[model samples]
Target: MKTFTIKDNVKKFLTVLFWILIWQVVSLFTEEILFVSPFKVLPKIFENLGDLNFYQNLLSTVLKVSWGFILGLIAALFLGGLSYRFKVFQELISPLILFLKSVPVVSFIMLAWLFLSPQGIPVLISFIIVVPIVYLNFYEGLSRVDKSYLNMAEVFNVGLWKKVEYIYLPSVRGYLLSAVELSIGMAWKSGLAAEVITFPEFGLGALIYNSKLYLDTVNLFAYTIMAVVSCYILEKGVLYIIRRILK
Candidate 1:
C-alpha cells in the first residue's frame, strides 16, 4: 500500500508538471500580447505571498464567503427539516426553490446590487447559490431515511433532539457532506463573481478587477492563482470541520 501510494503521488505530480509545461509553451507564444510566462506569474505569486495586503485581501474574501456559507447551510438544514415534516410547506416552497435554481448567478448579482451594499453583494450571491443545493440535497436524504428506524424511535417516545442526534444526522451524513462540498465551491465562484462586479474595497475579486483595469496581466494571473488556491483550501478546511463535528 505504501509503495502504491508513493507511485500515485508521483503520477499526480507528473501530470501537473505536464500541464505546467504546456502552459509555459503557450505563454511563450502569447506573453508579448496577453498573459505573461509562468516564471513571471510564479514570482508575482511569491511576491504577493510576502505582502501583508495579500493576506488582508485573502482574509476579507474568506470571511465574507465563510459567513455566506454558514448562513446558507444553517438555513438549508432548518428549512429542509421543516419541509420534511410538513408536506404543504414543501409544496409551497417548491416554486421558490425552482426559481432560485433557474436564475442566472449574474442576474442575481446585478439585481442584488441595486439594493445591497457592495460588501453585502457577495454574501447574498453566495447564499443564493448555496441554499437550493443544500436544501434539495438534504431534503432528498431525509426523504430516503429508513422509516422503520423513525417509527421505532417514535414508539419509544424518543426526544426530538435525541431522535435527530441518533437517527437523522447519521442517516443524512453522507448527503450533507456531499452537498456542502459541492456548495462551498459554488459559493466561492459566485461570491467572487459578486466581488468582481461589486468591486468592494477589499477582496481577491477586487484585486483581480483592478488588475484588469490597469492591464496588469501578471498581477491578474497572480491574484487568480491566489483565489483558486484559497477556494481549494477553504473546501478542504470546511470538510475537515464537518467531519469532526459529525464524528
Candidate 2:
C-alpha cells in the first residue's frame, strides 16, 4: 500500500513537470509579450502577493462567489426538503430549475447586468449557476433515502428533529458534499465571468480584464494560477470541514 501511494505521488509529480516543460517550450517559441514561461508567471504571482489591491480583489471575488454558493446550498436544502414532502411544490419548481440549468450563463450575466448593480451581478449570476445543480443533487439524495428506515422511524414514533438528524441528514450528506464540490467551480466561474463583464470596482475578474487590456500576459497567467489555486484550496477546506463534522 505504501509503495502504491508513493508511486501515485511520483506519477502526479511527473505529470505536472511534463506540463510545465511543455509550457516553457511553447513560451520560448512565442513572443515574450504574448506568452510567458512558468518562471515569469511565478514572479508575477509573487509581485501581486505584495500588493494590497491584489488581496482586496481576491477577497472580493471569494466573498461574492462564496455568498452565492452558500445561499444556493441553503435554498436547495430548504426546497429539497419541502419538495420531498410536497409533490406539487416539486412539480411547480421543476420547470424553473430546468430553465436555470438550460440557459447559457452569459445570457444570465447580460440580462442581470441590466437590472443589477455591477457589484451584485456576479453574486446573482453565481447564484443562478448554482441553484439548479444543488437542487437536483439534494432532490436526488432525498429520493434515495431508504424507505425501510423511514418506515421504522414512523413505527417507532420518532420525532421530526430526530428523524432529520438520524435519517434525513445522513441520507443527504453525500449528495450535499457532492453538490458543494460541483457547484463551487460553477459559482466561481460564473461569478468571475459576470464580474469581468460588469467590471466591478474590486475583483479578481476586474484585474484579469485589466491585464488583458494592458496586454500583460504574464500577469494574466498569474491571475489565472491564483484563481485556480484559490479554488482548489476552498474545495479542500470544505472537504476538511465535512470530515471534521462527520467525525
Candidate 3:
C-alpha cells in the first residue's frame, strides 16, 4: 500500500513538473507582458498570501459562492426528490431543465446582473450553474436504485428514515458526489466570471480584472494559479468532509 501511494505521488509530481516546464518554455518565447513565466508568477502566489487584501477577496468570493452552492444543493435535492416521486413533476420541469442546460453561462450572468445586486450576482450565477447538474445526476442515480433493496425494505416494514439512511442514501452517494465534483469547478468559474463583469467590492475576480487593467501579466497569472489551486483544494476538502460525514 505504501509503495503504491509513493509511486502515485511521484507520478503526480512528475506530471506537474512536466507541465510547468512546458509553461516556462512557452513564456520564454512569448511577450513578457502577455505571458508571465511560472518562475515569476509562482513567487507572486507567496507574496499574495501575505497581503491582507488577498484574504478579503478570498473570503468574499468564498462566502458568496458557498451560499450559491448550498442553496443550489438544497434546491436540487428537493426538486430531485420530488421528480423521483412523481413522473408528472419531472415532465413539467423538463423544458426548464433543458433550457438551463442549453443556455450559455454568460447570458445568465448578464441577465442576472440586471436583476441581482452586485453582491448577489456571483451567488445567483453559481446557483444557476449548479442546479441542473445536481438535479439530473441525482435523479439518474435515484432512478437506478435497486428495486430488490426497496422491495426488501417494504417487506420488512422499514420506516421512511431507515429506508433513506440504509437504502436510498447509499444508492445515491456516488451520484451526489459526482454531481458535486463536476459542479464545484463550474460554480467557481461562473461565480468569478460574474464578479469580473460586476466588480464586487472585494473579490478575486476584481483583483484579476484590476491586473488586466494595469497590464500586469504576472499578477494575472498568479491569481489564475491561485484560483485553480483553490478550486482543487475546495474539491478535495469538501469530498473529504462528505466522506467523513457519510461514514
Candidate 4:
C-alpha cells in the first residue's frame, strides 16, 4: 500500500510538472497580457488571499451555491421517489429532465437574465444544473436495487424501517454519493458561469470578468485559480462529511 501510494504521488507530481512546463513555455511565447506565467499567477493569487473583497466574493458564491445544491438534491430525491413509485410521473417528466440535461448552462443563464435578479441568477442556475444530474443518478440507484432482496423482504413481511435500513439505504448510498460528487462541481461551475455573465456585485466570476475588463491578466489568472481551488476543496469537504453521515 505504501509503495502504491508513493507511485501515485510520483505520477501526480510528474503530471503537474508537465503541465507547469507547458504553461511556462506558452507564457514565454505569448504576451503577458494574453498569458502570464504560472509562477507570476501563483504570487498574484497569494496576494488576493489578503484582500477582503476576495473573502466576501468567495463567501457569497459559497452561500448561493450551497443553497442551490441542497435545494436541488431535496427536489431530486422527492421527485425521484415519485417517479420510482409511479411510472407515469417518470414518463411525463422525462422530456423536461432531458431538456435541462441537454441545454447549455450559458443559454439558461442568458434566458434567466430576463427575469431573475443578478444575485438570484447564480443560485437558480446552480439548482437547474444540479437537479437533472442527481435526479437521474438517484432514480437509477433506486431502480437498480436488488429485486430478489426486495421480494424476499416482502415474503418475510419486513417492516418499513427494516427494509429502509437494510435495503434502500445501502442500495442508494453509492449513487447518492456519486451524484453529490458530480453535482458539486457542476453546481459551482454553472453558478460561476452565471455570475460571469450576470456580473453580480460579489462573486469570483465577477472578479474574473472585472480583471479582464481592466486588462489585468495576472489577477484574471489569479481569480480563475482561486475559483478552481475553492471549488475542488468544497467538493472534497462535502463528500467527507457526507460519507461520515452515510456510514
Best model number under lDDT: 4
Alpha-carbon RMSD, each predicted model: 1.3, 1.8, 1.2, 1.4
Model 1, residue 116: distance off in Å is 1.4
> lDDT per prediction?
0.92, 0.89, 0.90, 0.93
lDDT of 4 by residue, 75-181 (tens): 99999999999999999999999999999888999999999899999999989988999999999999988999999999999998898789988999999999999
lDDT of 3 at 185: 80
TM-score of decoy 4: 0.95
Q: Considering TM-score, where higher is better, how would the candidates rank from best to worst? A: 3, 1, 4, 2
Can you give the TM-score per candidate against the true fold? 0.96, 0.93, 0.96, 0.95
For model 4, what is the error of residue 107's alpha carbon versus the real structure, in angstroms, after optimal superposition? 2.1
lDDT minimum window of 10 residues, candidate 3? 238-247
Query: In candidate 4, what residue range of length 10 has the lowest lDDT sum?
Result: 238-247
Q: How much lDDT does candidate 2 score?
A: 0.89
* Candidate 3 residue spans exceeding 4 A from truth: none
Give one digit per residue, the lDDT tens place, for model 3 in 1-247: 9999999999999999999999999998999998888989989999999999998999899888888988998898899999999999999988888888789988998898888888899999999888999999999989988999999999999999998888888988999899988888889988999989999888999999999999999999999889888888887877787677656
lDDT per residue as tens, model 1, 1-247: 9999999999999998998899899987884438588888899999999999989988999999999999999999888999999999999998999999899999999999999998999988889888999999999989988899989998999998898888888888999999999999999999999999899999989999999999999999889988998999999999999989887
lDDT of 3: 0.90
Candidate 4 ranges with C-alpha deviation above 4 Å: 2-7
In model 1, the runs with Cα more than 4 Å from the true position are none
